[model samples]
Target: MSTDRKPDIALHFAPRTRSFVALWLLEELGVPYTLESFDLRGGRPTTPEFRALNPLGKVPLVVDHGRPISETGAIALYLGDLYGAPEAVPAADDPDRPAYLRWMFFVGNVMEPSFCQKMFGWEVAPSTAGWGSYARMFEVLTSAVDGDGWLLGERFTLADVILGNYVRFGLQFGMLDADPRLERYAARVTARPSFARAMAIEERESARFPPAAA
Candidate 1:
């Protein structure tokens, strides 16, 4: 039994969703925290107890100092700042800030929405759709990963933390095919000890919750 202080940051997780992103971020930060796994399909997150934390009933929510924060992007950015790894996340004044911020937002704003749309059999008109289309989004993503091991070149930054998870999710869900670049990148990110540990936790928790009805 470990006796670390009740972490000021607690993550509400559900396996195989955006929770993995937060899990990876927490692992990367090497922070001491608690993970409260919710079975979303079982309404574990919607119960009166959890509803007080998030009325929307979403997983991947975080409580920091008793204040609730929802959405994966927000949680990732917050963790990056709190952990303060300049290598993992560049400072605002850093010359790489623009590219770094662009890719970070791209995962949430572009990739995720586009992924959901395509996964659900919805089609968006290119003229009005913010992501243009799923095809275009993949093209953009592949192009970004074309050059190097990391998104912003040799240094692995928070943008990698964001996009790396997306790539892994896309591959696991079959939303993405094996692009050599993405395949290589995914392997590199998951090969990290922290990511491997997070994956182990996710797998164990997933077994605890059976799948929803067909």
Candidate 2:
């Protein structure tokens, strides 16, 4: 079931942000969509109109035929299934679908909070927190991706998009410096041509919205 009637997809985006992951996924899909790029410093996300669609006031919000879908994972799953089905998204009965969904959720459910925990020096019991401890999160991720293929093996699905971006950002933020498995995994993820194209766009946009002078 498709959400957008006209396929007039719009990505509310920002340069050098988590929006990059969304942008990357879009490029991988090779779909024609409009980019509503803006500088967050200008408060585009805070406006009432934007908030009406995305109360979280976050970038990487995708609007499909005027219907807004926020959150990277949700957006990724939605767009992938809607547009890239049977390729980026497995069929409902596909064996890979199970693994795909699990890895898709892992980034948000485990990785994100765990990274924040480590970054902010928050101490939470592994059993208490949703993501467990950062160390435990890394251990599990290492076990998952410490291999010669993508998360779903031969076929690269949207799980790669969701989790791969996590790995890339993890390395960028020095969060995954302790492990080489994720490093190798990210190497393959970045090696994709879409990653290159997305980085190119990211460069072009970042230049337009250059960082403010320190």
* CA deviation > 4 Å runs, candidate 2: 1-6
**Candidate 1, run of 10 with poorest lDDT:** 1-10
On TM-score, the leading prediction is 2
lDDT of 2 by residue, 85-157 (tens): 5766887787788888888889889999988887889988889998889988888888888888888777888
Best by lDDT: 2
Query: Relative to the unseen true structure, what is the C-alpha lDDT of residue 36 in candidate 1, on a scale of 0 to 100?
Result: 88
Give the per-residue lDDT digits (tens) of candidate 1, residues 54-105: 8887878999889898877777777776674778787878888889888888
TM of each candidate vs. truth: 0.89, 0.95
